[model samples]
Target: MGEKDKAYVEIYDTTLRDGTQAEDVNLSVEDKIQVALKLDELGIDYIEGGWPGSNPKDVQFFREIRNYHLGWAKIAAFGSTHMAKYRAEEDPNLRALIEAQTPVITIFGKTWDVHVRDALRITLERNLELIRDSLAYLRPHAERLFYDAEHFFDGFKANSDYALATLKKAIEGGADCLVLCDTNGGTLPQEIAEIIKEVRSRLGKDISLGIHAHNDSDTAVANSLMAVSVGARHVQGTINGFGERCGNANLCSIIPGLVLKMGFKCKAGEPERLRRLTEVSRFVFEIANLPHNKYLPYVGRSAFAHKGGVHVSAVSRNPETYEHIRPELVGNSQRILISDLAGKSNVLYKARQFGISLSAEDPVVKEIVVRLKERENEGYQYEAAEASFELLMRRIVEGRKETFGFFDLISFRVLDVKRLEDERSLVEATVRLKVRGEEEHTAAVGNGPVNALDNAVRKALLAFYPELADMELEDYKVRVLAGEPGTAAKVRVLIQSKDGEDRWGTVGVSHDIIEASWQALVDAIIYKLLKSRRKRLEAA
Candidate 1:
């Protein structure tokens, strides 16, 4: 499409407000401020901070945000239309919106007749007045006023005339944009497209339209995209599809879709910035304390992961054969999962990923392949434990191996004792280490054997490397190998460790659970120390 014919869609992020509605998703005022800054950095057009009338946290959020400078995003304060019992000027919600002092104010009002009568217990005419008065009152205070027609799709389906009447009232009240909301999230893409087409025809070509969709039907992203395809110029979504019920539309997926697939320009439309979609998506997930959904589209870990032999072989020859879009387009890399179904090409590709100089014809490559298969058979999954696999590959490839010795471990002992008199069990660990030919012995007690072991090791090494204090174990997971002796199954342990700047995962497998955990813990500490040493050397 030519520049003259190009469509520009404004991307509005509601992660702090709508996203917090998702179960188990909560953000502090500081968190809200951080996310708003990140959205601004990502070139988002608008950020709906929160509803100031709903809670004191949101009110404080508005106050806190006044201190920061948002380069591109206009912060929006969200609320509902005036209550039926109060005048727009007297409404607490409207007063709170004004207090927020944002450039944009968005207020959602009931458009469905059922919601108007059943929820609000007000006449249809009264609801229309509420919509009009609320926007009219805020019109002078805000640079842009948006009226979200709540339950719009269902309202239009049930009573098209009433829904259109509500929109007309909002327009007459001087709303800058009319947002059509799939509040129930049950509308399909085809239905949304047709309804939007009808709305555009009735509302006229000059009227700006926005879409707000939920994911209860698992089509929120699809519905939003469909609305844009039809004529909606503004798209409202939360980061990672977070909201009440299923979620709102996912901006991570929608941004790339609108820009790359639909030829629309959004703030995130620039190719270079758009490539950071994965980083941004993961950052939001991290802030939410939610695990990243590996199966998510565009920015997921497994989006470009190939597991099957034929798929890996073909992707190796030409990524275009199995991949739809280039992985680099979204700042994600192609991952070749090693499994029983993997071929020699998978091993070769993996070797290259580690920067190990090995050829398809090299005997060591075959050796590595056999080693992977044999270890996998014994319950080692390199795909989920890439750190262990990388160390293994380094160990197998002679002369290319890196040294793992930062400190030498002399011995360790763990003691677990339960006393009837105490009514509580006790665990203690002692670790002996040698650094620069000097030996240090340290002992510590902890809630569990692993904790004691971690304490003892760190206690012994803290003098030699004080920065180790910054590194702590974040997560520890244990999975027993399936089809093995149930009670005697060999357990695989994965430990994730993080310093202030970076996180790394290490793995170990053994029949003894404690031993496996110890191996992983040791590897975690080693990885951290090695990384720190490298940074120091680079600085020097």
Candidate 2:
């Protein structure tokens, strides 16, 4: 059969079960449904919703999703094998799987003597019995049965005979699919390839195979690909590399490579599912309240971005000279970073990218670039805060100087309380400022303490530049200091604002999240108003 007609590869996502094991990740049923719908729309074959017996929330999640049409993907309920000595029919864990009402069920079986003898407190033969009985018991009830040989990689290396024996038992027990797990996340890619080759060579005719690798050694991606090359047809992972220890193999990198490069039919039938890769990669991080990845392959902020004089010059001539693929092919955009490593070509190219005109021979480009490096060396990363960088560009390259840019807020404070009516919470804030003409005092209230503080600062600056009303906070971020919980609080805030096509960021540091938010908010407003006047002057 041709590649397209070959037995189709299945994409099994464990974002709910495996992904939640990532540090500080918790998703409500609604969040799970939103992500599942996105995954289903992307055409994944299966979604391992969660281990239902582990929590009530997951049980409810299956109930909630069951009411909706699953489209191409079947929501699989995940659980472990029946308890060490209990019959599969009487085990509550097995019953929980039945109650989930999913068409598919995945149960993990112990593959390592270490886990069997110590963790499960069962004999090797008895452990294999659990694997056999669990699959046989559930196979009759479900449309599909998958057995995850948890820690199979390590189990194989530690005791090759037992590991292969476990796979044999599960296959004989009527598992529709058999999965080899790198559960401890300590297997090397070459080891994964060698063992997978052995498994493929010996059991090639007996069972269909899949892989579940982890990233503890940072080789999960490589190991996963190695398994695929060695005849594994199913790839099990989470979107955006979520899981325990380091993380699972990054399905973000795997699925695209499989479908687009290896010609595998992993996305059901819709090949266009490739385009949603970057967006869903970002969407998952957002729902989990995590920061965006800057260098994630095929989709990070810097994947296509170029810096350095030589690099930017060559990129301007032909993007393919530097870029592996057109960034749009993967839903990412190219950027030019301004840094101390940047050369004249880099400066000019970045200036042009922002619609600001500057020449290599122009003294202003060189002057501003040097001063910019100096500012960054002192703790201003305009890269992460492009809004701040644009304001600087408008001031110099475009000859847009501001006469009233001296509005400086010396301090600000915010206070809020929910102890109120069903109405919105009360927010109060005050600011002390020094304007070019004279110092000013202003106060304002908003729906929250951060918004109130932002209002107070912006209201104070509006006295000097009324255009501040046109500028607004587009985004805000607060990061607490490492190793310090709350005692001596330290916060960092990044604010993004836009006027027309120009956006800039300003950052602030304080002991209070509210104070830091106001500082960055004020910087963003000032930066936006300044850039607008600069662009007007450039046009003039």
Residue range 1-540, candidate 1, lDDT tens digits? 665147889999999999999999988786677678778878899999999999999999999999877788899999999988899999999999999999999999998999998999999999999999999999999999999999999999999999999999999899999999999999999999999999989889789999999999999999999999888999999988999999999999999898878888987878867876876787676556455698999888789889899999999889999888887787676778874333356566567776778887888877787787787667665443456667778778854323365678788899999979757789999998887679999999998889999999999888888989999886666777656678788987777677788556677789988888888888788767767876899999
Model 2 has a clash total of: 3
Give the TM-score comparing model 2 with the true structure, all chains together. 0.66
Q: Rate the local accuracy (lDDT) of all candidates.
A: 0.85, 0.77
lDDT of 2 by residue, 1-540 (tens): 365445467889999889999997778786687679878977888999998899999998999997677678999999999997699888999999989989999999999889999999888999988989888889887998899999998888889889999999898789998899998788998898888888878787546899999999998888887888777888899988999878899888887677666666666334456666766787677556576677898777678778888989888788888987766555555667754434455456557767887777788877887877676444344434655566667777656543235565566767676785786777799888878757778899987777787777777777666777767666565655444577575766776565545445577667766656765675677666656677689999
Model 1 scores a C-alpha lDDT of 0.85
TM-score of each: 0.69, 0.66
Model 1 residue 193 CA deviation in Å: 2.0
Number of the predicted model whose TM-score against the real structure is largest: 1
Task: Name the lDDT value of residue 179 in candidate 2.
Answer: 93
